[model samples]
Target: MKIFSLVIVLIILFILVGVFVKRRSIKIRRIKKEFSVSNEKSIMESIFHKNFLFFEHLNNTFKEKLLTDSYVLSKLINIDGVGIQITDEIKYTIFGLVGLLILGDENPDYFPNLTSVVVYPKMYISDQRGQNKSVNLGESWNFGVVVLSWCDVINGTQNFSDGHNVALHEFAHQLDQQSGQADGIPVNLNNDYYTWKNTFDKEYNNLLREMENAEHDSIDFYGATNKAEFFAVCTETFFEKSAVMKSEHPELYDLLVRYYRIDPMKIFSN
Candidate 1:
């Protein structure tokens, strides 16, 4: 009787495993189909042109890829608006920024660990870190979630030259957390880990010194908070103030170009 019970349990387990595999396979196929379909190009292009200044600057090939990537991300990630109506424009705009971040990668995983984005109408109060209440423009949780302020996002999109972008800032934290920790380092360093660490440490210390002396800097002073925050702030400056960063910090600019595999200077040059 015990032998028979064990056999039955094994059979049930096998059946459950098979069912899970089949469902996952079906989901993957649907995602691939959705990604390949280009029926929404006109609508997406309109949204991009209206909201994202960077879109018009991109070449035709880059624009098409960006749209396609944005579409896939829109479909994959669940975006929920709090105290606000979720619209196609909002979805595309948010995902378009994400798409831009990974645009240079040959095989973008599309932030596999990120499942959902929660957007508030504006900055929100949070007590998640215990007793202290804080107002935040955005937050990126290490476990499959990101939160953003819609107003801040819009502001970030409006002025491409400004280094303040909540979406880019928070999403950058998400990238930094991909290595199972929210350190300044991310994965796929391309064998430049030592250089990356040395450069980031040196730059982070420099930012700290600048903050202490109350000196003006192209990079934001907020980056002095920590290595992770510094990376995020650097990402914002890299894309928005590409010309200034390139001219001022060529080594850092070159490092970013290699890591991102795209130069914002090319897009912003025209």
Candidate 2:
């Protein structure tokens, strides 16, 4: 009887060890797959793939820039059950490395972790009273999904020549929410929380004050409504009109550059 009980305990211990080792192996594989960097062959393949035309219209240097590694790209493109309709310049506009590199970069923490994306023909209007023909450009839900209108995507892309892209604006919200909230504060920022809060709050309120008086500004008035909107609108301009934003709102532009950890003016102006 004693021998049988000892054998049973040994079998259970071995089974538990086997399960633990298997689970650990799975976790390591998932991490490695998620963080793999781009390479020559992958870049070439991405360039030739039909879907990659999204990056073709941009300058050659920008074209070669990898928007995201395979892992991140897969995660980003897998937006939750949403339909992605690639059309017109959207394929090119979205493929441009500017927005991806600007809004997403390599940072997995404060970036679009949403697994699914839905694209529309253009500015999709939601017929709510008091709202005219308005296109609901992008919406980042807590459920790890995002929606975008390609028309707005192109418009925002072309307008990059001026200073705005609705796509970037919406995605910035997704990035903010990676920390689990879209309140303009990212989880990985190194600044003192209180300082960031005070600066953003003050600037947000000031923008609201200016918008109420109809003052001319580089950022869209929509940004004045709230902190999240402010982050989104500023991102639109950051990639679209970096020079203008840097010139008009130097402090805001600098802050954005620091937050995103990239300088579009350096990329675009170079």
Q: What are the models' TM-scores?
A: 0.87, 0.67
| Tens digit of per-residue lDDT, candidate 1, span 84-141 | 9988888889999998898888677678778899999999986565547789999998
What lDDT tens digits, residue by residue, belong to model 2 across residues 1-270? 999999999999999989966775565456445445535335444533444333444455443334433333443354322245553234334434324644434433313355566666655665544547555876666566666776666555444465566666666777677777789886667764676677778778888888889898888888877788888787777777778878988877777777776677665543
lDDT of 1 at 47: 86
Name the lDDT value of residue 144 in candidate 1: 76
lDDT of 2: 0.61
Error of 1 at 126 (Å): 1.9
Best by lDDT: 1
Find the candidate with the highest TM-score and give its number. Answer: 1
Model 1 CA deviation exceeding 4 Å by range: 1-32, 35-38, 129-131
